[model samples]
Target: MSDATSRKVKRFSESDRNSEFDAATQKALEEIDVCQNEIDSINEKSSEEILKIEQKYNRLRKPFYEKRNNLISNIPNFWITAIMNHPDLSALLDETEEDCLHHLTKLEVEEFDDIKSGYWIKFYFEENPYFENSVITKEYHLDSATPTSESTQIIWKEGCSLAQNVEANKPGKKRRHEPAKTFFSWFNDNVDPYTDDIAEIIKDDLWLNPLQYYLVPDVEGDGENGVDAEEVSSSEDDEEREGGEEESRNQRK
Candidate 1:
């Protein structure tokens, strides 16, 4: 038994020395003087490093994987309905060709660097009305769903005001009552006929639903007071600039 143990120790020590020698040889190969040769060696080293990193972290990042999957799965179905009913934004989705729809549907939020940073929805369709360019790519932070007080207040006020106005008018009174619809429904009903076709398409597509929450411009005051478009534009610009700065910082990192 003592002799067997000695043999096992000898084998392990031999294996360890072989590993150290191989590592030293690889390091020497990487230090080659030729630029092209060095580049090739570096590429090989990088690939091996990447494989090691992936093997180590792939299981660790599984939570982010499940979170993104849950996010996509739990997205409300009504969102699609709302998008279809959006006046200004529905047209952008409508002009998208069938090929664009297929691509959009196949997009999955992927994890990068253990951060859910590269998860983006990209729409590549001609004549996109929502943005300056025909292609729209938007990255959403994982924590973007956390509501701010201002956003919560705006949502509550809009929904409550609309509901209150609808309930206030007595049905018995012979009021020239146009059907009281929500701001979004009214906008959809009133938009140009040209957009109606696209709006219908938006209603049918599932991918567009995820964007519905951002479809309508936030309205302030009742129809009597009206909203200031200039103020809204200025606020939007500020948000865009802040977002741009954040993106720049992220790129540097």
Candidate 2:
């Protein structure tokens, strides 16, 4: 009778233990389901937020598109006519087109060849007179031996700006002075919209000034170049010292 009683007690204890384990397992499974549902809900919300932001950006881009088209249409036809007429300018424009195509295809050149055209156009518009004016004037005296003879005077006159303004405001202005826009227009027209992945390829090719490149690093560390080599060595030394102190304390304890 005593042996049977002991056996029965052991069986009951085992049964209780099994029941507790099952309850714990069931709770854990429920928690996992709840966590999965929450994750799904968060992901759905994030996706919706992202879609809304994209839609907002798309709406904002509409104005820029309209402005770009208007600018293109407003471009004077005379420049195109001039480019067609002038052999040198025409050749330069053709070379620029070829270079641009090469860049779009291979992403090799950093700046478009039309950049030179733009510079020329800008110079033309500015009417810089450096090319035509020969006025000689001295302002400073170089030597003390003959004050009058050594007096240096610089002859400066506005040449290009005057010419550029005159040309730009002519009664029937035919040329486009804005080089950047001209280049952009040429790019849009010549490149295959579907196949030219140049935009994606060139997205990261933006010209960053030295300061801009390391702005964050400058803020966090010593300057744009980052903490000097000496500073880095010093920091390492400090860390080593702290580690040694920690080990020493542990040993003492």
What would the per-residue lDDT of candidate 2 be over residues 85-178, giving only the tens digit for each residue?
A: 3323333344443332222211111222222111000101112233232221112121344321111122225432212232342324453433
Error of 1 at 22 (Å): 39
Candidate 2 displacement at residue 240 in angstroms:
43
Query: What overall lDDT goes with each candidate model?
Result: 0.41, 0.36
lDDT of 2: 0.36
What's the lDDT for residue 235 in model 1?
79
Candidate 1 similarity to native, TM-score: 0.25
Give the Å shift of residue 3 in candidate 1: 44
lDDT of 1: 0.41
